[model samples]
Target chain A: NAGVTQTPKFRILKIGQSMTLQCTQDMNHNYMYWYRQDPGMGLKLIYYSVGAGITDKGEVPNGYNVSRSTTEDFPLRLELAAPSQTSVYFCASSYLDSSYEQYFGPGTRLTVT
Target chain B: GIQVEQSPPDLILQEGANSTLRCNFSDSVNNLQWFHQNPWGQLINLFYIPSGTKQNGRLSATTVATERYSLLYISSSQTTDSGVYFCAVVSSGGSNYKLTFGKGTLLTVNP
Candidate 1:
């Protein structure tokens, strides 16, 4: 079903470099989310959107930005990336409200030096 | 901010064994979910169970929202089940639709 897909499976960036992580869902989900999982830590939400043009900040929204111009896409951008930003990033989508199950993408591993 | 806590931060089980993972939250929630992150860092949805009990293959989950706690059972453990299991919750109010996650329970099933 191609529930959710993310691009740039692995990436390495130098400090101050900016890059964008792409995410798409074919499930026609109305909700999209971005999360980062640090080693030995649980996932933390960076940003989310309830639908196109509707976005909000999550637990950890610093150093990142997101845009949801279409239902199938929710991309996260890192500006002036820092080494602390290095982590495994995941994108997810859900069909119903937050009460329902969320489908997650494979994840993108980013390393900033 | 709501808080979620998972038990037995780390566990090592033998293949064919049985184990139970628990998740506790600080308040009432409208929904709850469980996921297993594989060794390759892939997040796999295990159960969408917000309440009651549901079983799939050798895995089952039960959530008593009233008690603000949930339990996941893995029977006949397998090496494939070796990974991190996370539990998340969405509180009752719509003020926040974000899922608050627990630290997770790391399970290593030896074959």
Candidate 2:
């Protein structure tokens, strides 16, 4: 069902480089999220959107930006990639029902040198 | 910021063994979920239990909001169950959909 899809499975960027991580969900869920997983660390929220045209920052939103212009797409933008931003990024979507279960993408592994 | 703690950072179990993973949060949450991230980095949802118990096949979960703790039980564990188990909670306020995750429990199953 291609529940959630993230583009650029892998990327290596030099410091100051910029790139966008694309995420799309076919479930038409209202909630979408961006998280980064460091080595041996759990997922940390970078940003999240409750619905289209509404977005907010999360715990570790310092090096990233996000926009939710449509229900099917929520993209994370890295304006000036830094070494600290190197990590595996995961995109997820949820229906916000009683279960509150989130479906995640395969993930994007990024390394900033 | 809400704190999440997962017990037994590392676990080793033989095939067919049973195990329980624990997660304790610093505050009450509107959402709590368990996920299994395999070696390949694919995250699979195991449960979305804010409270009460729910089971799916050989896996089950229980979240006690009042006690600020949750337990995930894995029965008859197989090699496929070897991965990182994560517990995440979404606190009240505008961050309801944003999850705060624990360090995770890494399970290694020996067949």
Candidate 3:
């Protein structure tokens, strides 16, 4: 089903530069999430959406924004990239009504210079 | 915010051996999941066990919700099993789907 897909597997941005990491899932999931993982650390949630047009900040949401305009897409925006934002980003989706297990994307590795 | 802690931060095991990883949460949780992140950086769902015990092939997991802890057991390990194992959970009072991850237990299986 192509499950979940993310664009620009790797990216390098300069301080103050802005970019968006794209995430899409073909599974018709009702819940989508964005998370960042630093070296030797577990993933920290950045933002999540329950459905189209519903987005909320997560545990570590600073320096980032998100929008879920459609059921298949949830994009994370980095407004002003910082060195601290350099980490591998992951997108996940799941059906809240059933099979609550999350399916993660391949991850986008970002480096802010 | 819920706190999750995984033990044996690092471990090295020979092929065909067995190992156990533990995850402890600071508060009650409504959901728990186990994942294996391979060296190539793909997170594979191992189990969605929030409580009780479940087994799949050479791997099994047991969660004691009342105790707020979970255990993952790998039997007959192989080189393919080398990776970082994470235990994630959602606190009972808040968003049930918002997973809080433990730092993870890095497992290295040598042939």
For residues B1-111, write the lDDT of model 1, one tens digit per residue.
789999989999999999999999998887799999899889888888878999999999999988889999999999999999999987776464777889999999998
The positional error of residue A103 in candidate 3, measured at the CA in angstroms, is: 1.5
lDDT of 3 by residue, B18-75 (tens): 9999999999877799999999888999999989999999999999999999999999
TM-score of chain A of each: 0.97, 0.97, 0.97
Q: Who wins the lDDT comparison?
A: 3
Off by over 4 Å in 1: none
Question: Which residue pairs in candidate 3 collide?
Answer: none
For residues A6-81, write the lDDT of model 3, one tens digit per residue: 9989999999999999999999999999999999999988999999999998889999999988999999999989
Question: Mind giving the per-residue lDDT tens digits that candidate 2 earns over B1-111?
Answer: 889999999999999999999999998788899999999999999998999999999999999999999999999999999999999988764345678899999999999
Best-to-worst lDDT order: 3, 2, 1
lDDT of 2 by residue, A1-113 (tens): 77899999999999999999999999989999999999999998889998999998887899788999999999999999999999999999999675557889999999999
Residue pairs that clash (backbone atoms under 3 angstroms), model 2: none
Q: Which scores greater on lDDT, model 1 or model 2?
A: 2
